[model samples]
Target: MYNSNYYIPDLVEIQRQGFFNLLEKGIVEEISKRNPITCFEKQIEIFFYPEYYRLTKPFYSIQQAIFYKKSYVSKLYVPVQITDRKTKRVFLKWMLLAHFPLMTNRGHFLLNGSARVIINQLVRSPGIYFRENMHEIYSNKWSEKPSTSFRRFYADIICLKGTWLRIECDKDFSMWAKMKKGPKIPLLWFLLGMGLSEKYILNSVHKPMNLLESFTKEIEKNQRAKTFKELKYPYVSTSKKAWEQIQKLFKLKKTLRKSSSKNTFETKKSSIVSSSFTFFIQKRTEEKYNKNNETKSKKRIKNVQKGDPKQNSEKKIGSQLEAHELGRKWFSNKFMNPRTYDLGKQGRWSINKKLGLTIPIEQTTLTALDVLMATDSLMKIEDGFLEIDDIDHLKNKRVRTAGEALQEILSVGLIRLEKSIRLKLNGNTKQTFIQKNSFFNFHALISTRPMNGAFREFFGTHPLSQFMDQINPLAEITHKRRLSSLGPGGVSRDTATLAIRGIHPSHYGRICPIETPEGKNTGLVNSITTYAKISVQGFLESPFHKVYKGQVQKTLGVFFLAPDKEEHFQTATPDLRLTSLGFLPKNPIPVRIGKRFVRMRSHKLALMGVSPLQMISVATSFIPFLEHDDANRALMGSNMQRQAVPLIRPERPFIGTGLEARVVSDSGHAVLSKTSGYVIYSSGSKIYLYTF
Candidate 1:
């Protein structure tokens, strides 16, 4: 059965490339078209009165700021420039210490009234990987012997830009298979059975002629054989060699067993005798004397004590012999149970069981032989021992690509196949499914769903306004913007803690050393340096030069160039000229030498080669002072400080308190005073200024 859980869809179709592009593009367009000051005002207004919440008709209150012991006019009125009809003039406007929207050094925005900051997530590079797994085959009820052990090997080719393909095969050499979201089949026969030319198969490999010839020979041999059993048998020479190897392995195993058994027997016998003496020392000494006397009496009665003593001694000797025999039998039974004794007889089989051996000894040896035969067949095919015309079944199958061959193998293994679909905004469209029997549609499914709900909610929407409503409810909008470190396949909370538990060299240039949370997430979740950039290619470029002066030399350097310029080998000179082929070495050169490189000692460089770009100059890319501040802490400060209220005293003290307070009129107007002793105090009914 096809496992949907393991099935991963194409990354290209599912990634929110467009969404990220639109966000950045919209901000740039807004900046270019609108006046900075006017835009700031409009943003502030909208932030305080978000359209989504305003539409719900909720009650609103005017927020105010107070100035203590100062005239309202002096503190509130500030000079501002006003542009009217292309003429600029100075004007006095009522200005308070009201919070305004501020754009952070990072590409995030703060809502003036809400005191929230929005942070964009970091995107990671994608790549392909080969995953290894083991499969178990259970025994059939009818067969008394164990089930045939099978090892399944597979590779997952995840093309970040294209579709994903899974290629698999069993160790049995029966067939090779491929899968995307379905079962497997015999790759070779499936391709040939689909009527694809041998040329196609040859092209799939680095050396086509060898594969074709070997494949042809196997087919020809199978055709000559009358039964499956005959086809399964190896050549006389190969079988003889394999048999000899097996016999040698068996003999070696036997010798090792005999040596081990002798050692164990000696140790166990000594231990048993020593243990018996501890429990029956007195009885054992008496039995020995009795045995000697009995032997002496058998030859001469006079040797034994005369009279009743002689009879009693004889009876005691007989009882002692019986007791000794019983003890010996009891000790033997206790120490050597039937199961334990049988284990020694089982020998290698018992060892194999402990080692979790899946394949039988003989079958394992035969499998190795089969592998050699398969290799030999490929060699013969490469050497041109067989021709395409010799195989009659080639006319029936038409497998085209390596992927198709894999799919065919899976089909033969009785795996089910299904069609995958792609969901489009316009409508739901059906992706064409490849027929197992046909060779035309061999490519795997090419679409995948969004990895998670957060991805969909964040990237799927258009305008920022629309996203704000979903994240912050209209009924109870929060002033705080939630920033999450988690993203698609990103370092989770647990993983983040693990990364910070121990220091690593790779973290030196990538993670911020000073900037981390002081809370539960301390050191675990951290910010990357401003200059740090993740490579789309999934590999970091190290800064090193192959040639310097007259001799080939390596130097630590990081080159910062435009992506396009870097691709064309253009140096970041005044004119931005491309370097000549002769002057440029075959290997990549560093873009720029960072401060870290300058500080590095010559011995350090010689000992441990230069570090990769990701390992240097991390602080350059982030905000100067804010980079070290914890994100959670910053958020808490922003929200908490906004709600802070100043403390005021009702009575003035004899010593000057050096504290000033502002009184506001009941009509929401600031009452400013020049008197130093004037203090603004608030009561239940009215705000009052008391002079002491």
Candidate 2:
């Protein structure tokens, strides 16, 4: 490695890899699995099982697409096999799945002859994120005094595609849960619904006996007490009292169930019209009765209702229990079932990596152990044993490239296609299907419209999908490397807070601090640094050289470190002068480790940066004498560079930074000579060279 020198990495490799990944690993592997669509009742199964797919050499080339105003796309053919189990008959054929869009060499999709690029989105990663908020509540006392305030901690379990589960501690120190933004329910009740015994929960939260008592008292106050004024804080309750209350609640629930069972079930044929007509007749009959006798009849009706309080109470309790059971079932189906609440492979990996859990990555849905651990972490935060997360930090956010976005759209379209296949299978009976063997038209039954429509919807309406910026070669490449935080499943620009828009320490080398926009989207939209690359987990990383015991190891090469990993190592700046032998300066050097800026011995240094400009983007690095200019002016300078127009007689800058040559080479502006040659013939626009 060259000492104190930096080599430019592939700038547009991210975009290139993303598009190619979709074509290879994403679309073919995920969508071509065996038995993609199945209909058990009709004894039919449709397999996507890829026969072959073509990514390169599309049906319509880029030139043709531009001339004909068509999309440059490749055809996807899958071997579809339809099996009738009853008759043991099988129909096999190769069917067209879709006309998948193909990307150009410059990483752009040619849609309707216009080049488009999907801006990479910076989204909060899927995992349990903890937060604490303070709220003030009026005192129960009548005296005029300052209200008391309490800090409430919350843990949110975010999934890739399902309901969100938020657990928060109330002002009373009782834990409650809200699923899918539903009304708050006692954590104990939620656990109970999940089939956890009451005793187990009591044992779990009782480590801090006060939490258990508060939880039990809250349950009793909500269920038994009629007046809120009677409730008091700092509740002191024994285990016996808690057990007694729980038993009473169960008994009451049982009585309600028995009473509900006594009632007759409503017929499925009951219509809203019939119910309205009956109500109208009842009202008419009531009008015909004398006004004086109306009160007496109503009183008689009340007395008759009061005659069996148990019956009336049972009816009310039964409805409440039914609603409670319905909520339980809904949560189970939407949050617990693996089929409905898929977190995807990446989501599962993220959760496991974040929590350091040993659970298999294949278990994508939320589990009881995950809930318990998340809750425990909240308590740890309260006790100062754990750190609350900064949601805006790069560690908590990741890049969603075009590959992921396309895969999501494709998955949705495949689902729609599956539904259509199931409908067709259900419609045809075995007798009719056997009689009309010609009806087995795989092409007719399966339409590529769903996939095509999906692509159209994404390209037409998505905020991230934009017409390519072709003002200059720099602009075109910059457009592909752009990252935004506003889109579907991303933070709304209107509601984004200042904390989220401000620069953070983690962005030092990953995102360019000076290359953002100027107005509302100033920080929401940004560009990656020159040497920065995206990790497998989508985290941004910057290259650094390893320093071992006051010496820079040339053979070690450059190591890419994400923000989270970099925080653990002490890094020295490249400004420090090194000896001829590549040894560190013989003094306590000022180094940055984590958030602390301290002077440490050279032997303690872990990493040495390559250059000061490594933290800046290409546009910002191209400025001559950038250090002398103010940050605000430098930011404007960088912004204006992308808008620079090409000149008729192009000339290099008179006063320039050494980066001009590299930038020009990377921008695809100059065609470099590959071998020793001499120009034999030259024209006004072309140069012909003769080489040995």
Per-residue lDDT of model 1, residues 564-634, tens digit only: 12233211111112244313233333332321223321222221112222231221111223435675555
Find the 10 residues in a row with the least total lDDT in model 2.
264-273
| lDDT by candidate, in order shown | 0.29, 0.71
Q: RMSD for all candidates, in order, please.
A: 32.4, 10.0
Q: Model 2 segments beyond 4 Å from truth?
A: 1-5, 32-34, 40-42, 50-56, 138-146, 205-244, 247-329, 353-356, 430-439, 661-692
> Model 1: what TM-score?
0.27
Q: Which candidate wins on lDDT?
A: 2
lDDT by residue (tens digit), candidate 2, 1-692: 12236677766778877876777777775566324576657476666665365444587777899999999988777777777677677788777777888777667889998989999999888888889888776666664754877887899888888888898887667676788653465565555556454445545652333234334555565456443234331111111343454444434434534656322211211122122222222322333442558775455345433565643342232343454455456558867886578776667776777666888887888776677666666777777877888887798888998888888888887777887877777776545444364445676578999888988999899899999887777677678889899998888888999998888878877898888889889899999887888887788988888998899886678899988889888998867888888899877988988777899899988899877777788778878777789999999998888898887887877876666666556555567777769999889888888998
lDDT of 1 at 151: 39
Report lDDT (Cα) of residue 688, candidate 1: 62
Tell me the lDDT of model 2 at 196.
52
